[model samples]
Target: MNRFALCYFLLCVSSAATAQDKEVQAIRTRYQETAKKVQLLEQDPQNAALYVHRISLNDKGTPWPAVGNYKKTIKFYFELGDEQVHTLVRIDITSESAAHQYATEYLFDAKGQLVFCYDRMPDGQSPENNIEVRYYFSGDKPIRRTEGKTISDKPSPEQQPQAKRLQSDAAELQSLFKAIDK
Candidate 1:
């Protein structure tokens, strides 16, 4: 009778532990799915940017006018996978006649701790300003950061002054990214 009781107790304990492990695994799987979304976004910023922007596009392929007092807009995109989280935010500046787009990206670990981040202001064909920033982290702590900017270059005095400062800034950012990649 004593031996049977001991075996039963151990079996109960093992079953409880297995249940707990399954629960933990489920939570981790959900978290990982969320993080992967960000990695997918980074792999295709332009398409992702376009996808977000299309939420407000018109038939003519141009952005529609602001509806009311709201002239600026913000959007958040998230992805999780492999115990990592990626987040992207886009800020839009809208006026009566023009609009601008800015965005930020972030990454987090399985424990919901930030692991990396990247901020970007895409330099589209437009002659305008641009900016990019990146941060790398380890175990909820940032270990490195890189920032870059592109100021359009003003056209020569003999010609019309184009959005030169923004162009210049974009070029600078490109070189900066290249350096860091190496």
Candidate 2:
């Protein structure tokens, strides 16, 4: 084929791929929104299980951290089984004072129940006062967090913090999917 003809063929292929990516992305966005909306309807108090949204909540909030630092973040992990329950939850402090201590992790259930978690201050000045967590067995189910019943043997209320930084640049991530669709 002539040089111009070969170039045209390649262009067509690229265009097709881009179109496909857009369609798939559209579906993914819809599904994500559906899940979040469903959770909101089911829970309603803004305290139920957390779900991921198509757009990053951080996007609308303050700018990400500076050089040599991970960006601020608020994260939620959904369950993997039948209805995909929410297992873990966390919120980052997002302030410079906290620095390395941006996220103080906390564990929770789909019903917004608290569980054992780990947290340490950035200055390392905290004593045994550091975040303490305990686990207890309550009848058939595990009661991780206790309000004031140590005899009941419930775990303390704390959670593990999530990674503050994005795995990759957002623009690049979007472009990658776009390329795939083509």
Best by lDDT: 1
Give the alpha carbon lDDT tens digit for every residue of 1-182 in model 1: 99999999999988976764564355445445654544565687655421222123232345555632223332334332345423222222222224345554443344444444445564665626655654444443333445564221222343222223323333343344334323
Model 1 poorest ten-residue lDDT run: 87-96
Backbone-clash count (model 2)? 16
Q: 37-125 in candidate 2: lDDT tens per residue?
A: 44673568366444432223344445455533334443334333465433323222232332344333333333433322333444456
The number of the candidate with the highest TM-score is 1
List all candidate RMSDs to the true structure: 20.8, 21.2
For residue 17, what is the lDDT in candidate 2? 60
Separately for all candidates shown, the number of backbone clashes (residues 3 or more apart, or on different chains) is 27, 16
